[model samples]
Target: MRTSHPLWPAPFPILIPEPRGYDMVAKALTIAGSDSGGGAGIQADLKAFSAMGVYGASVVTAVTAQNTKAVTAIHPIPDDIVAAQIKTVLDDIQIDVVKIGMLGTPSLIAAVADALAGYAGPVVLDPVMVAKSGDTLLADSAIDALKSILFARATLLTPNLPEALKLVGEGSTQAQAKALLDLGVGAVLMKGGHADGEICTDLFVSRTGTQDFSALRVNTRNTHGTGCSYSSAIAAGLARGMALSDAVGHAHTWLHQAILHADELHVGQGHGPVHHFHALWK
Candidate 1:
C-alpha cells in the first residue's frame, strides 16, 4: 500500500540536511528564573546561548519582578512543576549542556538536582546567591541545599566573588578556589569582575590545575548580568564540545567583548546589561 497523505508527497527525500558551518550545533538548556527585567537569570542565559551560536531551551523555576536596580519579588515555582518541565525537555531534546541559575529555595534546589541527576551531560552551575544589586536571591537554607545537591553534580561551577565567599566562607581568595574543587566540583571559575582592580582576572581551578584569565576591566558602570552571561557562554561552549579550559577561554572572550560594547548603550535606571550581540551587530 502506498502511504499517501495531504501533508507529504508520496515519496519523501531521504537526503539529510548538511551540517552547519561548525562541526556541530549545540543545544543547551537553562533551568532558572524569568527576569522580567530581561537582563539576568533565564533571560541572560537565552541571550548568551543565542549569541554564542547554540540552540537555547529553558525551564523557569521562578518569576521575578525585577530590574537593573533591584529584585523586588520572587515567586518560586512548585517542585513538581519544575521537575515536570525538566522531564518533558529531557525526554524530547538532546540537550548538550545544562546551565543552572537562581534556584531560590531548598525544595526547588533539590528538585532541580534530582531531575538533572538522570542526565550525565556537561553542566554549568552558577551559584547565583545574590542579585547584581546585592539583593539576596537564594535563601539561607537553600545555600546548604545547593552545595549538597547542585554543586557536586556540576561539570563546571561558576561563582562570583560574593557567591564564592558565601559557599566557601568569607575571606576566600583565588588560592582558595581549589578547596571548592575538593568539595566535588569538577571545575570552578571564580569570576574577578566583583574584585577591585584595573584588570579583572577570572580564576579557573580544576582537579587538573589552575589558570588565570584576565582582561583590562572595561571602565563601565553598566555591568549587570555579567556573571550570568559569562557562565551561560561557557555552557554554550561546552555544548559545542569544547574542553572545560577551552570553554572558559571562549566564554571570557565573549564576556570581554560584551563589557567593551556595554558602554555604547543604556537599559535601566541603574547598572545596565552587557551587549550580548555586540559582535554580531558590529
Candidate 2:
C-alpha cells in the first residue's frame, strides 16, 4: 500500500510501484449521473466503454431512481463531492478522453467545467436534457450554464433532434448544428433518431464542413441508452487514438448494431436497453 504515515518509512524514499491494468490500454473517464436501472447514464457509459475496449472511470454527478419506464426521482450529488470525484480520477488516471452526461443543475455543470479546466484531452458532451421515457433530466435553467461553462471545452456535442431544437431554438437540423458549432463546440453530432425517415442519418457539422453517417433504422423500442452509449463509444475511440470523424463513424455503425439486437435482452417492461455487448455476446 502507498501510505503516508509519519511513523512509516518517511526517512527513506519509497519506491513507487507501477500502476496495474493501465499498460497499453485505452482509458476513458465519464463525469455523469447514475441510473439504477442499469440502462442509461453511467451504466450505459461503462457498458459502451467496455464494448469499445476502453478502460472506464466514472464521477457521478447525481443519482436517479430510474427504470426503463421513467425517472421517478433524482438527487444531485454535493458539488464538492462531484468535484472531488472528477479531480481524484483525473489525478490518478491518464485518461485519453472524457464524456459528460446528465448534469441536471447549473451548480453541477459549473463544478464539472471547473474540475476539467486543465484537462486538454478530448471531451464528448452528451447534453442529456430528456429521458427515453419523456422525463426531463436537465433543468431548463441550466441550459445557459451548460453553454457558457462546458460547451467550448467539449470536443464534440452529441444531441438528439429534440435536444438540438431545445438548445438552439426552432430550426432545421443543419442550422442547429451550425449554431452549436458557433457556440465553440469543436463539432456537433446532429443525431437523427427522432427524425422520421427510413434511414437514421447523423450529421457531423463543424467549421471545416459536414458529413453524414447513415444507417438503416432498426425498429426497436429497446433503445433506452442510445445517446449515452453512442457518446461513450466515441470517447472510447478517441481514447484508442482514432480521429474524431473516424470515432463518430465507428460509434454510429456500432450503435446501429446494438439497436438492432436490443430486443434480445428483454430487460424491462418499458423502453428496454440496447444490447451494449451485442458483438461479444452469443
Candidate 3:
C-alpha cells in the first residue's frame, strides 16, 4: 500500500498534521498568446502572477511579432496544439485560477472552451482586442464565438471602454457592465482608462451588487500591458481566496505604483511596459 514514487523520500516520524495546501503557493494558468515584446500576453501574465506571489503556468494559443511600437504579425497556434497544451497542463498542475488573455481566432477560442469543459474554478477573462500601440489583436468574427463559448464560464470579464462598447454598443459604464452580465458572465469589471478624467474609476458589476474602485491615475506612456497585468493580479488574489471585490481593489492599488514607477525604466521608444515588480523594486 505504500506506493510512493521511487524518487520520493517519505516524511517519517510525522508528529503534527499540516493544513491542506499549506505548503503550496497559489497556482494559476494563463491561456493566452505570446508577446515578443514581453509586455503583454503570456509574458505579462507570468510576470504579474509572480509579482502577486502566485505560481504561474501558461498555455500559448498564438505567437505575435510585436514590441512597444506595434504588433506586426500574429501566428495563431493550431487548434489541436492549443488544446493539447491546455490538456497537458490541466492534467498535471493544481491550478487555482484560470486567467485567459488574447486568443486570436474562433477556432482557438473553441478549442480553449472545449479543453476547459469540466473545470470548475475562477476564470478571469480579459478581452484583449487591441494592443497598446493601436494594433488589432482579436478578430471581429471571433467575438461571437468568445461570448457564446467562454463568457458563461468566466468568473470575471475585464473590458475597457472601447471593447465593452463593441460588445454592448455605446452606453454608460454601468449599462455596458449590465449588458455584458446579460451575456451570462458572472461579473464585469468596467475599466476606465480610456475615459477622460484625473480620477480613474473601475466599476465592478455583478448580479448581487456593484462597487466602484477609484485610484489616482498616473500619466505614463508605459501602459503597454496594463490590462493583462491587472487581470492577472485579480486572478492571483482570487487564487489566494480573496473575494472578487477585494481582488479588484488589490489590483487597482498595486497598478498605480507600477505606473507611477514606470518612467524610471527605459525600454522601447514606444509605449513601454508597466513595472510589474514595482513593490519589490521600490
lDDT of each: 0.83, 0.87, 0.86
How accurate locally is residue 146 in candidate 3, as Cα lDDT from 0 to 100? Answer: 89
How high is the lDDT of residue 210 in model 2?
Answer: 80
Candidate scoring better on lDDT of 2 and 3 = 2
Every candidate's CA RMSD: 11.7, 12.4, 10.4
lDDT assessment of candidate 3: 0.86
- Report the lDDT tens digits of candidate 1 across residue range 239-266: 8777788788777877888877887778
Clash pairs detected, candidate 2: none
TM-score of each: 0.90, 0.91, 0.92
How many pairs of residues in model 1 come into backbone collision? 0
Show where candidate 2 strays beyond 4 Å.
1-22
**Candidate with best lDDT:** 2
User: Residue 258, candidate 2: how far off, in angstroms?
Assistant: 0.3
Query: What's the CA error at residue 250 for candidate 2, in Å?
Result: 0.5
Ranking by lDDT: 2, 3, 1
Candidate 2 local lDDT, residue 27: 89
